[model samples]
Target: MSLRKIKRPQGDFWFDFEAFAEDEDGFWLRGPVGTPWRAPHATGSSEVPVVVLLAPGRPWAAWWVGDPADRRLEIDVCRPPERDGNGWQYVDLELDPVLHETEGRVEIEDWDEYDESVRNGWMTADDAKLARVVAEGCAQLLHQRSEPWLDRGWKMLPDS
Candidate 1:
């Protein structure tokens, strides 16, 4: 199946992945290295295996990248994903909490873009507030390494 991410004021990104597993929380998707992905401006294949967790009612999606040098974990603050056909789709809230394992730190990224979206009315005030809350909470979880999905996703990674 494919996961589609709709970015406010801009593009749509989609990637095909195996529906590897599912539980009470939500679905788990696995994309092997070389899996193709497309965005409005560009297209490419993943350089490493990836696992993503999309939990319904949670305002974020968690991703685990297999490469150690890369940002190992990234949480995209967004609206809860909705099932679409055989896939899922959500509108990105723009803020993201990324864990760079090599650096041993978590960074909140894309704040500028998020601010722009809010200012331009690409997102409503309530949506912007929700995004901020989710982003901050996710960042704290990333910093403390306390999110269960993070560990679950790590373990699910191939050869983790």
Candidate 2:
């Protein structure tokens, strides 16, 4: 997988995206093609990953080396991703679990929204736990400078 530095309100960091593809063994394979991420097996065997964003120590947030061991984020929701007018999608209102990095720790940008989701039955307890696991896992994976942070298994829709 390839990574590029991006500047956004969430924070500045290296980012990349991946698509899932069934491998020869039928298990899903992810990542670009070549290099460390060129080939990575899916951990959960999920056929299609929702959407994700990850960043390293925080060059976007200011180069703060983070502890990959830390996992204390309260995942609030994992609603359907909001898509833009052009069809590009991103986490946004009604379906967003904000992530942030501070002093080497991954933090949730909003617990209120997450709580509200639970209060309104917008997100279930089980789904909340799944979201938490995904966020925490991302926190750990993004701590390193390796290509793992930019992984995307090369599962993109063809431009026909």
Candidate achieving the largest lDDT: 1
Error of 1 at 38 (Å): 1.2
lDDT per model vs. reference: 0.88, 0.32
Runs in model 2 deviating more than 4 A are 1-86, 90-105, 148-160
Alpha-carbon error at 13 in model 2, in Å? 22
Candidate 2 least-lDDT 10 residues = 57-66
Report the Cα lDDT for candidate 2. Answer: 0.32
- lDDT string for model 1 (87-137, tens) is 989999999999987787888999999989999999999999999999999
Candidate that would win on TM-score: 1
Instruction: Estimate the TM-score of every prediction.
Output: 0.92, 0.33
